[model samples]
Target: MSARPEQREDRRKDPVDAIVDQWAAVRPDLDTRAMEVFGRIFRLSRSMGDRMEKAYAPFGISRGEFDVLATLRRSGEPYTLSPRQLSATLMLTTGGMTGRLDKLERAGLLRRSPDPHDRRGLQVTLTEKGLDLIDRAVGAGLAVQSAGLSALDDEQVGRLADLLRELLAGTPGADH
Candidate 1:
């Protein structure tokens, strides 16, 4: 059975609705169409994350592990990156990142070695098996992403991407 529709009259029922109400009262003359677009984008981001987590589950890896592996894979340098570097690139707390590294090490997907340039530093490198595993996991993840976008036609997808890029480029302090 289809899910029951929410009551349409309840204008302030959801968080977005409440925000709209507040903005309508506070700044009635300002343009709010951008806010609507961004609000849906924010919600879509959360939904996308959940779908990505589900996609990674079959690889027996958490989202954190997948991110680390992907970073090393993309680094194009023997799959090695210092823990501090990884933390900075991944925007994770150093302590939390250390724990992820430890977990990956325990899983035999990565290893730590003394950094040649620094006496007190270690570089985390992926093993051969780890590379193979991540390769498969990445393929699966791409399939999931493709499935998620199946509803959009080729032209729609391209247009959406271009529009999103334009909007993203204009955001203050946006990540390049």
Candidate 2:
């Protein structure tokens, strides 16, 4: 015997619902439909970010460092890109990128050498160690994410992705 629809609905109410109810009691004219949606999104992002950080921990890389290595690994054969290109692609400041590059290079995970095409530029390339690490780290991260989405069936996941994509596309400053 399953619970009634109204009973299920009551069980689904979360912290955001409580907040909305509080607002409603004080301000009946206020509309909180968007609040319910974004509040859950924010909470989900925070929780998943923590989980991802833990997933990458055993690889000796923080989530940000994992992103740096993953970026190079995804760049195809030779796994090289100019520092400027990396900064632009990662949407990170040049100084911030330099720090990550320095750390990775020191770890023997990547190397920096003068760009043959441009004397003033340097190229960053993933070493065999970096390549191996990213491959494993990516799998670990994906497993965490997959587990997180296990509650949703494939169809629901696809629908959620499409809706989120549409919402992100419409958001200002979210270009690309």
Candidate 3:
């Protein structure tokens, strides 16, 4: 039989391909397209997450901490938000947010102050140090990601991004 389109295009036998082949051998009746796609996505996420963790490590932050700092940095001037806002944006629980805030505050990377408009609420603001660290960390993280994507050309990357966006939009409970 002639090689499949994917096989003809690239003869690589990735882990996901190996898995699909095993399943096919055992149960040829099963359809594994979704498994193949999601399996590759899952593996990519894991591997990239590790690379990102390492990328942020030199700045003395984990991926989660980087998320917190990045969120604030992207918020623009004054770089302040309510604790509740931060929790919501990060999709983290209030307790979890508190732990991160405590650590960042202790490290002098951020500050917590009583909200002037709301006596009962508190505001979180990024310190100069936090902003500087996040700026550098973001660049490093992007470098690592760019290197990983170097295998694909610009058009291929764009197409992949569009496809992933479509998949994410259709996914249940995913943010629009």
Error of 1 at 7 (Å): 20
Tens digits of per-residue lDDT for model 1, 63-164: 889999999999986999999989989999999998989888998999999999999999999998789989999998888888878989999999999998
| Cα-based TM-score, every candidate | 0.80, 0.92, 0.94
Model 2 per-residue lDDT at 101 = 91
Q: Note the clash tally of each candidate.
A: 0, 0, 0
Best lDDT among the predictions, by candidate number: 3
lDDT of 2 by residue, 31-50 (tens): 67788789999999999999
The candidate maximizing TM-score is 3
Candidate 3 C-alpha lDDT tens digits along 68-141: 89989999989999989989999999999999999888888899999999999999999999999999999999
True-vs-predicted CA distance for residue 55, candidate 2, Å: 0.5
Task: Name the runs in model 3 displaced over 4 angstroms.
Answer: 1-6
Candidate 2 regions with alpha-carbon error over 4 angstroms: 1-11
Please list the C-alpha lDDT of all candidates, in the order they appear. Answer: 0.84, 0.89, 0.90
